[model samples]
Target: MRRTTTVWMTGGLGLIAAGVLGMLRDNLVGSAGAPVIAAAAEILAAAALLLFAIGTSRESSVVARRPLGVIALVVLALWPFATQFIGRLLSPSEPIGDLAWSVFGVASVLVPAAAGFIAAVQIARADTVPSPWNRAPLWVFGLHVVAWVVPQLLFAAVGADDIQGLAGLFLTLGKLAYLAGTLGLGIVAVLLANRRRTTTVPVFQSASTDRD
Candidate 1:
């Protein structure tokens, strides 16, 4: 098995850890909450993206996918750090509304979304013989989008202040759903890598058949 396969699988595991951390952070209420824990989520997520990109780049059969993976990882890696900068910019005098952080947030999500799509396309369009895991690429992209966009829309539609009854329930549900989706992406990645290992068996299989 290629070392990169293990790398991708390991990265996926890290991503799941990140999502779990995020969910754990959300559960913290009142004074129990800590931003550092949430920060760990982003840091782990970025590391996962980078590791996955490296694995994809090492795959000999995949061509167009490499550059797209690189682009996606770059955005993913930078995503967590942006929040810190945005935080620093916010003050009593310079409020969130006064700045363009909202726009920045929206655009930031789009960057990974676009790159995910591109990389998925590359996996889909590989010129060589395809692996059963090829569809896994699309699954990775899809889950990532679900994690980002679905929660964003759900939370925004029901503002935090407006939540008196079902909104709070939905807010919690949305957060869980986002984490589940993120977890799903990692699961898919590891499964896909596992499946990829079988691709090498055909050569041995054909040789055995020839001998028989």
Candidate 2:
């Protein structure tokens, strides 16, 4: 019912679908077509998040805003990182710029991820807020960080040469992490979307209307 819930639910589901696609590459689907499906899913998820970030302000009704506002903005910024890699996948030889750029850029996701953590805490600390952020659940964002964001950061840091004998081991872990994060986000979103909140009518207003 709530816009926040709707958007978050969609964002979460998108992430989960993307994660499933990411894993299919190694399964019966085989490596060739699976990577393409995964890439498409990732792009779709990223694009959805980017669009959802734009909705935060509109959903909040252009208010003075809160920390979640910045969180949305940062999340919007984070999606572009995926596009760069996606571009590389589509055209590897075209040079998507330095890999170092990707490493550092991907790390920026930590900013919003941290912000989301703080926002979730803030919600827990306070009460009686308006829409756009009120009653929004965010533990899933942390899951996303643990599952995908952390792995990306580590992947960037641990080059092929650095892994040496542990390449396959870490690579598999990295892939698993992404899948977990995406699915976690999706589940959280769906839970939030279906959540129910009790609304109480003002006693005075009810009495006044009855009296009339």
TM-score of each: 0.65, 0.50
Residue-level lDDT tens digits of model 2 in 1-212: 25555565566677777767766655737646775785677676665455444445454211123456536544544545654665555543447556745754556555556655654554443432344444343544544555655445656788656646555755665665565546654565555555521122355568899999
User: Per model, how many backbone clashes are there?
Assistant: 0, 1
User: Tens digit of lDDT per residue, candidate 1, span 1-212?
Assistant: 55655775787798789888877887774444557777788888878766665554456323334666467556656765875687677564655554576676677667656766776666666642146555656765665555556555755787666535455655755575556546766776667667666765776789999999
Question: Who wins the TM-score comparison?
Answer: 1
| lDDT, residue 160, model 2 | 54
Among residues 3 or more apart in sequence or in different chains, the pairs in candidate 2 whose N, CA or C atoms overlap within 3 Å are 12-186
Off by over 4 Å in 2: 28-30, 56-165, 197-212
- For all candidates in order, the CA lDDT equals 0.64, 0.53
Least well predicted 10-residue stretch by lDDT in candidate 1: 56-65
